[model samples]
Target: MGTREIGLPQRVPGTGLPARVTIWEVGPRDGLQNEKAIVPVAVKLEFLDRLAEAGLTTLEATSFVSPKWVPQLADAEELLAGLNKREGVRYPVLVPNERGLKRALEAGCPDIAIFGSATETFAQRNLNSGLEKQFEMFEPVLAGANGLNVRAYLSMCFGDPWEGPVPAEQVVRVGKRLLELGCTQLSLGDTIGVATVGQVEGLLAAFADAGVPADKLAVHFHDTYGQALANTVAALRCGVSTVDSSAGGLGGCPYAESATGNLATEDLLWTLEGLGIEHGVDLDALVKTSAWMAEQLGRPSPSRVVRALAG
Candidate 1:
């Protein structure tokens, strides 16, 4: 897709929001990775095309992890091969280790992401490793991602399914380590959607105090408790310009049964439009695309904005 800019609204004095925000679309990778039914590769490619047509420039394409762990994305290589790579649009694959990194590199993936957990319990459960060991596992992957855009996703940043509240200090510590280890960006994830506005503010403040600029961080929220939009506003107010959301709310935490879907891209766009922030995404196109994908999944979209607009 050729680069295009949507006219930005004039910045209102005293408003802390940025002139433009980048919505990192994670539907193909994070959204469908946990689904019980495996999606066909052709459908996956069509989904990606629709997203690009809707002007989503940054998309998480697929994950190069062991299929045994995530069978839903078993065709990651095939999906990458079949993708219609667009100009000025990024398709970042997820690499869990050096092996995954090698696979992604072999497939000619130019961008990749690694995931870590803030709490020890989740680190052990999700990664099958302790907190420190998980970082050690990522070291080689980050090192091998030479000349590639490597993003770090820190999961369970606010609360954990096994453990309760995660400490702000620990989130800062691990997040700083990921940046130090060569991640170009850090996406703080509320994996279980338990983050409150106060927790979001506290974590951003802690990260700021630790000298990690907001420009290098992105926020990923789930709407399990209906706080995704509220938490997103908090992050934006804290100067975070990048946000991760899935189309049609097409995601849930496989590890946490209580967790619902991710913050819908349509819903996020609705809020950004209302706030007069420029994101360059066509809300109607996005909703229509998501509604079509939901049909493929044999369910209605869980996103309120999509439902309202599609109605």
Candidate 2:
């Protein structure tokens, strides 16, 4: 959404990297949330199956938001109920409030994600609440999740639109509070895709200083400014391994103008492969998936690797 200039400095050749990294594919959930054309439920199920076969261990399959807000995923409960659950693979659904959590529970989803904004303006606009009120809303959701033994993921930690340049301390405070409120992992989101490596480094450093280890953190990046991969690398360099990405780079913040999409799954895989970091995903299979989805939408594939593979 925001224009940014990133002059990538080449990394040294042959930098041996980690053996594997977990990719929590949010394509079905975050990716299609903003689609103008309605995606059939059966098509979504097949896509999930394809992603599973591609070896993604964690897949964010759907969201239980109100149909009035996200009509595309209106069949969230039916979608999850019909998914062929695989052993040892996680399917987490994005749950906005207690009602959404209830719907997800009814659909047999074992994991739920709760979202809150780092800025008051976005919070009021997105969730219709201020920062304190948003946390208050999470209190009930957290209590319910604890009672049901379900896992929670927190979103919107990195940057926000309403308030420009959210302070690192505020991010730390929000993250720590979510951890205290029973979120299993805190995902620092570059919501408007405005974060730079320097800002990312400063935030991770502040979190480390606050004693929040990187192990409990995941980075959610958007490629609106074509810097998501760079920001992700900065997080990995800070020892944050888990990253959230969407296939075909679908979805943009409705409130954030000019936001392109979340970082594509293919793009992340390319970065991992170039770094020699192991990820269980089959790159070719992922490219196929992205290309298929892009065609279904009649849109150009946002993944550079997908385009290259197609060529």
Candidate 3:
């Protein structure tokens, strides 16, 4: 069966929320990176095209990490080469370090992201550098960016698997450094989905106190503990309009075993639509694209909206 048409939720017109939110669609790069089998480059390109067609303006296309680390995205260059690259949409790729940045520059990348960790252990595991050295590594990449749109992802902000709860000040302190490195946006990551509403608020408040405005911050939450939406609402109420999510709930951290699927784009869109916030995503089209991806992956989509509407 093809994707089933879904009904739109009634608008409630939530108060104290931004009029519009930018959904940083990470399904292509982050979602597909978690798969066990290598998705064909053609399929990856098609997936990106479908996402753009679904009205996602910022679709993360691919990561420039070494194939030895993430073989799933080994076809990153190929996928980018074949991408249709819609005009109004931004296709950002992950650049791990100088090498990845070089590759991105060679490919004429218009946008890129650098991933960092909130704790020392995760930094060592994910980037092969200590917390202090992580910034050292990102320096050259940021310098090379040369005014292209760049995003910095600060993972494990709410909680860490090995390090436990991360202090709000610590996240703000480190995140500020990334911003100082010339990253236009900093995405606070709840890598293991352990963040509660209070944690979200406190961290945002801390960022504000640290002179980092909400406009420069984005929230990336995992749904492992089923609090992704709740936390997102908390962040939104705190004046953060940028949210990072994976389509069809299809992403997890390869370096962190406790991490599960990312906040689903379909689910987030439903919440925004009901709240009367403009996210600019076509929910039905997004659900259909996710449903199609589920078939390609040989599994049912984990997104509640996808299962309820399109399954």
**Model 1 lDDT tens row, 214-267:** 999999999888999999999999999999999999998765667677999988
Give the clash total for candidate 3. 0
Number of backbone collisions per candidate: 1, 3, 0
CA lDDT, every prediction? 0.90, 0.80, 0.91
Q: How close to the true structure is residue 295 of candidate 3, measured as C-alpha lDDT?
A: 92
Question: Which has the greatest TM-score?
Answer: 3
Stretches off by above 4 angstroms in model 2 are: 1-19, 147-158
Ranking by TM-score: 3, 1, 2
Candidate 2 structure lDDT: 0.80
> How do the residues 1-311 of candidate 2 rate in per-residue lDDT, one tens digit apiece?
11122222244433323455788788999988889878999989988988888889899998889999889999887787789877778999888999988887777777788887776777787889987788899998888875553344544566666566788888788778888888878888887788899989999999999998987888898877889998988888888889999887878866467877789888898888777787888777777777777777887887776766664
**Could you tell me every candidate's TM-score relative to the true structure?**
0.94, 0.91, 0.98
Question: Number of the top candidate by lDDT?
Answer: 3
TM-score of 2: 0.91
> Model 3, residue 182: what's the lDDT?
96
TM-score of 3: 0.98
